[model samples]
Target: MTKKLTGVFLVLLGLFATGTAAVAAPPPSGSTDPVGNDVSWPQCGKTLPVSPAFAIVGVTGGLANNTNPCLAEQLAWAGKSSTGGTSQPRVAVYVNTANPGHSGSWWPSSNTYANVTVSNPYGTCGSGGGGAGPVDLPCSYIYGYAKAYDDATIRGVTNPGTYFWWLDVETGNSWQAGTQDATALNRATLEGMATYFKGITAGKKGPDGKPAGVGIYSTGSQWGTIAGTVPPGSPLAGLPSWLAGAKTLRGAKSNCSLPGLTSGSSVAVTQYVAAGLDYDYACR
Candidate 1:
């Protein structure tokens, strides 16, 4: 379907987005500390060729840094996406209530021709609500969120082939900082969101009739300290597993300052420098 036609469908179906941070270049490489920083770029996702200790690629996104124009091409080459008619790239936008997107912003997404995942409506489970909802109940508002996504799909998105709708499991708290009382998240809170997310994308159908499991986001530190430690059969177990970390991405030095998060494994897609960055999900 044409882009215009797709937009029309989304409006009729009421499925769309509406609404931001980050790294200091030339400071020093591989320093998570806000004070210390990185000054080099790897043009790769692993780490420096000679010094493998420093990460080569890192993921960053938010209103602050998403606008780096060269990021996409860097990723395409980094992943060697040019092989097999694969110029398209899969992108994940990171957000919270703070940067919820404008009424009609299009995120730079993957090639409509390919089969891949693009999840939006991103952030922490019990967060971004302005503290109106409960702190964190197992399957708290997450079930409702699943129902909403499923419910929208049933009505039919403009181009189901072009886009797949999914919500963020955690906001700023997707990582841990070893400090007390940051971003309002805990095991139960995470569990509640994860359970609901699981129902929507991976397991049995939700009450709203959406499929099971879609996609998820969390930093590498969050993976090891938070999600990794979760017991088996929990909501987070089924996540697509994008372990956000610190490293060079497409020849840029990117960084994120989300609380409770630290670096670890590499992410499937990197979202460094998120201000004004264009991204979208291709519904072929």
Candidate 2:
């Protein structure tokens, strides 16, 4: 095999080995402290050897650049499976409000509003590759609506109010820096998304009989770099947090004790990377 193909094979093999080893024994019992896993297009068509206590399937393939090819199948699996005697499953979407490439880019200010013409100097956005032009809604609204639309249209999620939604933010994706204004814009983008979801699920209640809440899936450092310190009394501060960047189950469990980026919000989940697989520890 070519070097590139060899590298890819090794990575996959490593992931498989790690996933298998990690679940060699059944997870701990209890509905309150459930164990779960999250996946994207990469794991499509493969059945997990061990059934997760819960699952968080991905909707966007990468930074909203495109929809996941296996989104339908993943959603179906989540919907069909029951965890802790609950039918509802968790779902997550990629968020990159300031990436400078692709139609999903949210930088340059013009792309912040719904229904407006924006100039893309970085050769991102649209088929022709960036320039002055009218685009769809802002990145936040577009991402929020795209996620809700995909869940409803493709996954048959008629009432999204029933499931928990997570926004995946990571340093692996693009971000803004060098200026305070850039940070503010990023915060606005995130808040816009939360606002949209809140509006849609206003009167709707989840299977738990509570309005579904939006949560941030990120590490404190990553969040600080992208959006800066979450302002006091900010709406984002009230949303739940899903901590990431742990390397082991022990580390992940420890992360659960860390304070959330939002002042009022607490860490609801902690993610650990094992054998290249993303596993979650839900905080009871």
Candidate 3:
């Protein structure tokens, strides 16, 4: 969480959906939008933002399918978040994401999860052929789904569906390297997590009268390399974006004008680092 990872976009063999310029309209002049902070296991035993306007807590211990040691205590701290921002939520959680294929200890080998069979869009998961091993789309989807499910059901996060969820996609995590196929598999993994998050929040409205929100957190270039351009029909389409890579609050605010990770999504928050802590600026 201290060092930023850089990633480059891979050239796709086939054309993928391209995102439009999704900019965030700045808050009114002199508007006192609540500035919030995000924390995880890295912040354990450290001082946190004093009464942050809102708080985003990490659910993992810096890897997919892992737990944050301070989750319960952080959630309690997050519970103290104040409501003064526009698009930001009072309490939200993020999960680390990766697509390690079969190399991962918990890589998915089947389409059925928790006894329910999933209809994968990339055909059969274990059916695809990988240069090194089996890194098919279906398996990637299952891997993402299982991780998010574990985070929600067993990661000590109480009532996960009640809070907004952000998928932390960074180059620091284990991802398939090389060609477009890797990008597709990585994208599928994220889409799977989105499906599960959206499913759990279905029919349940939040303070904004919308289903618990699910969004992506990454830099534009990192997202391009990991997921390429998400298809408009894909589950990732239209989700909000939380852009990272700003040095100051002013820089973070300016990032709100940048394009979102997807064509249909809008930038909702821009993050900046100060004193080793990640601070977020509500864009809308």
Question: lDDT by residue for model 2 over 149-239, one digit each (tens)?
Answer: 4443454344565556677666555544565465665665566556656655666665535346577887788788877877775557778
Pitting candidate 2 against candidate 3, the one with the higher lDDT is: 3
Candidate 3, residues 1-284, lDDT tens digits: the string is 43352222211211132211112223323336568878776666666666567778888877786677777877877775445455677878888889987667766556777887877777665534433325778778887888888989998977777878999999888898897588888999999999999998776655545358699999998899899989999999999999999988889999999989997999998898876678788898
Provide the overall lDDT of each model, using Cα atoms, as 2-decimal numbers.
0.28, 0.55, 0.76
* lDDT pick, better of 1 and 2: 2
Deviation in Å, model 2, residue 3 alpha carbon: 24
* Residue-by-residue lDDT tens digits, candidate 1, 1-284: 01111123332332222110122223233433222111111222322122111121112222212222223433333233211111112211221111111121221222110132223123333323332333333122232333333333433222222222232334342233354532223444344334433444444432223333434444555344543455444444444433234333322223222322222312232333221121111111
Clashing pairs in 3: 19-263
**Top lDDT prediction, candidate number:** 3
218 Cα displacement, candidate 1 (Å): 2.3
TM-score of 1: 0.33
Q: What ranges in model 2 sit over 4 Å off?
A: 1-33, 85-158, 208-211
Error of model 1, residue 272, in angstroms: 3.5
Clashes of each: 53, 0, 1
